[model samples]
Target: MKYPIIIVTTILLLSSAVNAQKRSAPDWVLETKEAAWQSRDSQGEANEGNFGDVWYSKDGLDWTELKSDVIWSKRHEQSAFVFKDKIWIAGGAAEPDYKLDSEVWSLKIPKRWFRDN
Candidate 1:
């Protein structure tokens, strides 16, 4: 009985030490609550029309910003999906009276991109 207690106590101490070593600086995560601009009108209040910034993460918790201020027009509430082995963005509105975007954009991610990352 004494040997079992000692073993359990030792295990607990080692576990605590391991957990302490794991503690590190917090990670930065981006969340999209609303669009870019802030305006008084109903259109402005709506969560639409964010700038062109792309972020990617293999694990959802940790994210990396791939690019910022992309060439594409900044918009929000857009349709994003994976089709034809490519990612597509379509039909979103921009700021200033929430103008609509008729254009569609598709990105063909190279096969090597996934393997190299």
Candidate 2:
């Protein structure tokens, strides 16, 4: 009984320590949010344009921007999901015209995205 209690206590301590090491959000995220909110408040409209920049975060707070040579057209309202160890993005409206897109794109883990042609 005592050995089991010690093992459980050790596991809990290690879990807490690991979780505490998580990185917090980068400054750019807060700045971007504040700027967008201010713009919407002043202009009475929110811009829905897409910039085609991709960012990924291991933790929900901290983000890292990814640069790739492959070009994807600017889009919004996209549906993304992970399936079979690949991230798939599909069914979004293109920017500037808001035309509906039926195409799909997939990115293998730690790899650049490729259009599903």
TM-score of each: 0.47, 0.56
Q: Pick the candidate with the highest TM-score.
A: 2
Per-residue CA lDDT of model 2 for 1-117, tens digit only, reads 122323332332243444324322111121121111000011112273454555553323333456678846766566666677666767666666768889897766555889996
Q: Give the least accurate 10-residue stretch of model 2, judged by summed lDDT.
A: 33-42
Off by over 4 Å in 2: 1-48
Q: Write the per-residue lDDT of candidate 1 for residues 42-97, one digit (tens) a residue.
A: 22335632445444433232333344233346555556655665556666665555
lDDT, candidate 2, residue 69?
86
lDDT of model 1 at position 109: 49
| lDDT of model 2, residue 94 | 68
Each candidate's lDDT (Cα)? 0.39, 0.47
